[model samples]
Target chain A: MLTIDSLTKRYGRGAPAVDDVSFTCAPGTITGFLGPNGAGKSTTLRMLTGLTPPTSGSATVLGLRYPDLPNPGRVVGVMLDASAQHAGRTGRETLRLAASLVGVPAARADDMLERVGLAGAERRRVRGYSLGMRQRLGIATALLGDPLALVLDEPANGLDPEGIRWMRELLREFAAGGGTVLLSSHLLHEVEATVDRLVVIGAGRVVAQGALADLLAGSGVVVRATEPDRLAAALRAAGVTAAPTGDGALRVDADAETVGRAALAAGAVLTELRAADGGRLEDLFFSLTGAAGSGAPARTEVAA
Target chain B: MTATTVATTGDGTSRALPEVPRIPFSRIVSVELRKSLDTRAGTLLVAAAVLLTLAPVGWQLTHLTDGVPDFDLWVSSARGGVALFLPVIGILAMTSEWTQRTALTTFTLVSRRGRVLAAKLAAAVLVGVAVMAFVLAVAAAALLVASGLEGTTPVWGDVGSVVGGSLVASALNVTMGAAFGAAIAQSAAAITMFLVAPTLWQVVGTALLGDDAQWLDVFQAFARLSSFELAGHDAQVVTSVLAWVGLPLAFGWVRALRRNVS
Candidate 1:
């Protein structure tokens, strides 16, 4: 298990980049680190990997502080800043060098290259590799030691659709094999589809942390109906809230079955009746951070 | 029987998983050396050092035959070759990490930053020793050919000191280069400073201090250390070695260990 305890990092007394952020990711799970630009996702990852020292607090991997660990490369496979690679080295050579550093056999490099689907292009220099290819090479390098824990910062940044699919599957497979995986990404939709648990940060502090299901439990679903006034009345009677959407339809925050039944009971012709995908998760994110559209809702820290 | 067998097999398969081997430090150093050696620039630096050392010795062999055949002559000739080429080799070694972006891969594998620096320094010293040996061998061969023409015996003691001094000087130069690269953390700037700093120090010292200016020149100090000549002067050879080599290296180490890798 990876435990980050009260991790606080401040740059020159500026606002803490990562403030009192605490979370645990156990083996057999993929934890998605969600945050906006400049939200300290990268900084937090750097501190965890011991690339940068935290102003205060600590992160332990497998119950040992990063510096105290006997063999760090064997325990934690980190791929922070995917662009941190030599342009002159070939994809295969890069992994080979990394494996050698971690004291793994050279043959493992070829295996990892094939695993990341870069087998064909392993001989080609990294400078010639596309952004997606570089990302794959980075992943291969990370897996050279067959680490127990994986920490990736924006691993999906430059990936195409097919590459993203492969990455999602790869991460899931890694997690399934009883390894801890913590990935940070700006793609909320992808995170929603891939991760089981999430730690969402905003303006440097973790605003939400739990299983995706638990966080979305009280976050009511959106229901759209044609007969606006009648649907609103029915939703109120069913102890649900409804607001008129831009398209002149009542958007009710209730389950689809209840809203459909209420529309049927009200004898209102339902042109469209469906629950939206929990208000786009992004909207919930904005609302949680008080960073919604102009004149955002008054800042209220949501108690997790 | 088939149903019972399948149930038992499924239950047994879920018992446990085998362990994976852990990587060791020796492998890390070996890999670092391999990657450093594979580069085109690395090959060129070694080739240049070899050629430069042999070319001058080869020319000297073809010409002069009047002086006594001595290892001091060979040592001096080899030192001349090293004085010209080793600094360039040193610059290449230090800047290659940054220019290639290999620093990222290097640091990631050996996350303890200090170890990575240590490994690079060790590799550089080994290379410096090898290059010095090559220069000495080539110079000896050239002198033997000259001695055959002149029918004279060669002095081995002077040859040994020359080779030893060249090796020590080359090692110091390489270490200085690594330290400079670490402190500056930029290839262009580090290379430029490595090339120009000593010359600038020499010129400034000569203009200001007159005959005693040698004491102020960094290059002169380094040369004095290599020649073991500092008794007559106020500054000790030990002090010169420490100032030129030790101070810069310590500063570089601090910068490398503390600076955030960009």
Candidate 2:
């Protein structure tokens, strides 16, 4: 299990980059740490991996701080930056060095190179590698110790669609085998597809987090109508709070059935009304992050 | 620092897993040694050192104007060329982690940053010793040429101090370079400091303290490192070495160990 309690990091006198955040990532689950630019997702991951020290509070993997754990690489493998490998070394040499550092047999380097689909590029220097190749090499280095847990930051950043799909399956299999994973990414679709749970951060605070299904289910309905203002007022009259999405839509904290009946009683013409499916996670994300303005509704209309 | 005890799953169930033993220091050193030689920069730096050392040997043997050059002098001259450039190799080894931005990968693999740094230092020391040996071999070849030119047999009696002093001096230079590299953490910046800062300090000391500056000059102290027979300079040598090497190394070691990997 990964336990983070009130973890915070403040640079100089500025606001905390990661502020008083707390969450748990249990075994047998892939927790997607989602956030936008400057939302402190990287800071949090850095704290967890002992790359950056917290100003206050603590983050631990398996009940111990990263540095405190004996053989931390064997317990929690981390890939904070995919380009952090030495450019002068070959792909195989990079993994071989990692294996040696972790006390794994050198043969593990070849195995991981094949595993990450870089077998043919094993002898190439990282300086000549494409960004995607570097990501694969980074992943190979992470798995060199056959760690029990993984903490990856933007593991899908440089991957192509097929590579991303492969990574998702690989992480899923790792978790299914009783490993713990905390993956952070700004790509919403990637997180939605890969993670079992979601921990969303906005402005350095966790705005929402829980099992993916539960968070989506709790998001209620995304309703649209010709007279959005009137429909919103009627939902208010029905004791359901509706937040305007700045388009021809209102998001209510009630089921679609309840919203439909309220709209019917108010004599409002319904153009669209449904439990948000693909847009559900994105909707919940914007709402929690306080971005339910012009952007969310515009995106929803485009998707619709 | 050596081992972790979490053998069970996060759900409190123990699964059949392969046992991973703690990594020994020897393995870490071996990897560090391999890394020093594997990189282009490292390989080039060593190649350059060897070429530079041989250049001086070749010049002396071809010229042969000083009549059968003293074997000790011939070796010392060659060692001088090696010592001049060998420290750069050491600096590259120490600063490569930061220069390549591989500290995150390195520390993550070995959580004990101290051990990794220790391994790097050990690898550098090994390189230093090897460089000294290479210079000595070139000097031995130069001695044969000198003997051929002068029709005098080469004496092996003076080989000990020349070899011993050169090893100690070259190794010390490597360590000093590494200490500066660790403190600065950037290759260009550390190399600049290693090469220029001491010379600047020497000049400033001479201007400000006059004759008293000799007592604190790192170069003056290094000049006496191999020749303790100089007498009365022992204390100056210790103080100069401590000031130049020990202080920065201690500070850099702590910073490297504690600073955030990011």
Q: What interface RMSD does each of the candidate structures achieve?
A: 6.7, 4.5
Residue-level lDDT for A124 in candidate 2: 91
| Pairs clashing within candidate 1 | A101-B28
What are the per-residue Cα lDDT tens digits for candidate 1 across B127-163? Answer: 7777777777876776677777787776576554576
**Best lDDT among the predictions, by candidate number:** 2
Error of 1 at A102 (Å): 0.7
Q: In every candidate, how many clashes are there?
A: 1, 2
Question: What does candidate 1's lDDT look like per residue over A1-304, in tens digits?
Answer: 6888999888895677777888888777899998776777888888887777888889887556775555666777888866777777788887877776776788989999999999999889888988888888888888877777789999898899888898889888888877778999866886777888888877777777788765555444455555577778877888877776677766566667878788788877777765455453566576644652122222223333
**Off by more than 4 A, model 2:** A223-251, A256-273, A278-284, A287-304, B1-19, B145-151
Candidate 2 chain A: worst-modelled 10 consecutive residues by lDDT: A295-304
Q: What is the per-residue lDDT of model 2 for residues A1-304, given as tens digits with 9 covering 90 to 100?
A: 7889999999899667887888888767899998776788999998888878899999977677887766777878789899888889999888888887787888988999999999999999999999889988888887777777889989998899999999999999889877888999886887788898888787778777788877666667788899888888899899998887777678778888899899899999899887756466675565645652123222111100
lDDT of 2 by residue, B156-242 (tens): 665777778778877888888888888888889988999898899899999999978877788778768865454787777888888
